[model samples]
Target: MKKLFTSYLDTFKGLSKEIWWLALITLVNRAGAMVIPFLSLYLRDDLGFSLSSVGWVMTCFGFGSLFGSWLGGILSDKLGYYKTILLSLIATGIGFLGLQFITSFWAVCLGFFALITVADMSRPAFFVALSAYSKPENKTRSLTLIRLAINLGFSAGPALGGIIIASIGYYGLFLADGITCILAGFLLIQTLNPKKAKEVDQEQLVENPLAPHKDGLYVIFLIALALFGVVFVQYFSTVPVYYKEVRLLTESQIGLLLGMNGLMIFVFEMPLIAYMERRGWNLIGNVIGGLLLTGLSFLFFYIEGWPGVLVLGMATATLGEMVAFPFGNAFALRRAKLGRQGAYMGLYSMSFSLAHIFGHNSGMQLVNSLGYNLTWAIMGLITLLALALLFYVKRRANTLKI
Candidate 1:
């Protein structure tokens, strides 16, 4: 145990102070991520929208995310990540504060679209900032540290959100979300002085940087990423509803169950990533394994009636997430050319946005029509398809030597 603890600590060494500050800002912003986890529930129960309507609203959210990601990348490159991040956080905060006022279905859809567009604009900027802060040698670990902060906040957020929902109601959640985003913006201003920090030399990182759009192999990787995201995002989108309606779990129980994913990642992901990095494992192989595990996680839903299945599935999915996300992010970052990091990261973020666009609505529609078991089966099949594309990407990368 002592040796294991030491290894975990070792994983955190050598990351920049700026990365820590970035992680802190991420933690603060994500801790109020109470809204997304419970958005479907709020739409259905509080606003009295149909499940179909909820799905449509989520689809709009995805579109907004896609646009935001693209814009953020452009802005990061032009305005600098520091300014772009501040703009996103402050604007998103105000957007969230106004979101609660929209009650009608179409208005809610528009509200979410606008809100998410402003909110997700930070994602690419955040990635660019992270790349600027971290050294080449420690890039993966730095990514993991930021992810750790995100998961830790997610772990706390849902639990606290459940309590808030029980007491003051969903309005409280909106308030918390809005306030925290603004707070994070202010904190970033106070903490990270981009002018003073010694940025990693980009010229040394990539000798010949390829534009993300022009790179065929990277595009294939992005396709696979989108598919993986489709399966993975179900946890945030449809799985909560599944827990409540099918598994007969209460809000608090569901929150705890979802929180388990974050807690597990927080406890185990860093050391696991460190061990893999030390072994010099192939990034593509790690991602494939993670996607396979994630696919199998959904299959566990087949064993219905027992609440234990939910726990088991969450554990499997969390493990898959831990394995895939950091490495996948690292791969994207490494693949980026020095000058075009924003474009690369923007496209990467955009892939997940595509997943969000399709995944939520499709899962909900499947559940509404075909039943939960069939929906889980379909998600597994989708992952299989993603895996196939990834294999092709691996082959192409070898052929092109990218």
Candidate 2:
């Protein structure tokens, strides 16, 4: 175990301060995100809210995220990433603290929206900073390191959050989240020591607004990603209610099952991404593979009384994510114009926001109307359609290559 741990530590030795800062921020940010896996539980079990109402809170959060990501991209260039990161963390900390004291539905809804804005706004800036930090050749590896750290935090967070909620309740969990966020903010502020107003302007003057590779195929890739986002976002939105109602899992069991995704991501994501990097296969193919795996995984819900089967399905789906996410981001960054990388990535980030709003609203309605099993089955079908679109994009990329 010591030897294994040493190897993990070795990977960090060569990275620059910028990369380390990004990874640390990811860990800190996601520790706050720990609440999400259990938020639905809190709403339903603690607050006596309906699933549909829970969906509305999620939608409002998504709406705030959409605005936040847009603003982050635009402002990160103007204000610098360090300021954006620090401000976002402070805002998120306050929001979490507010959540601890306020239980009213409207007020909680407002808090959710505010927190989501702060959280989402920080994401683009973090990515932008990391991309700036790494050299071109090492970009994918650096990004993967960040993903691994975030998932590592996520892997520990939900299970820990579950225990906290089960033991001290949401207040304890909320306070811990708030505290960690403030620490993360301070760490970011001290580490980055960002430039003043004029330095940001000088950097912008030299950066090309449109330089990443421009092609129609990239747009097609983004569209396929948007569709996949719909199903992906449902895990936090409706899957909890489905597991509780249809599968007869308790809150703790649901938390365990959700944590399984983070565990798989934490364990397998880097190696899987590394292998895919070597495969030299067009990423569009891997995207389809990811969609198909995700679709198939949902089908495991049909297995009667098999919570373990659901675990395998989620693990498989995460495997797909490990592949698809990095590839898609790399593809977008490579294809985007240099100066507008933030803009394109920001728009790409919007797809996730849109998906959350659509997924939560639609998943709740569909589950209520069509039953949990059917709702999942339909989500599978949406993935299949996304797979088909990706297939088309692959052919288009191939033709262009030829």
Per-residue alpha-carbon lDDT of model 2 for 283-310, expressed as tens digits?
6777787777776777777888656887
Extract clashing residue pairs from model 2: 208-339, 210-337, 211-337, 211-338, 212-336, 212-337, 212-338
Per residue, candidate 1 scores C-alpha lDDT tens digits across 121-140 of 89999998998888888889
lDDT of each: 0.90, 0.75
Off by over 4 Å in 1: 205-209
Once model 2 is optimally superposed onto the true structure by TM-score, how far is the C-alpha of residue 162 displaced, in angstroms? 0.7
Residue 18's lDDT within candidate 2 is: 73
> Which model scores highest in TM-score?
1
Q: Pick the candidate with the highest lDDT.
A: 1
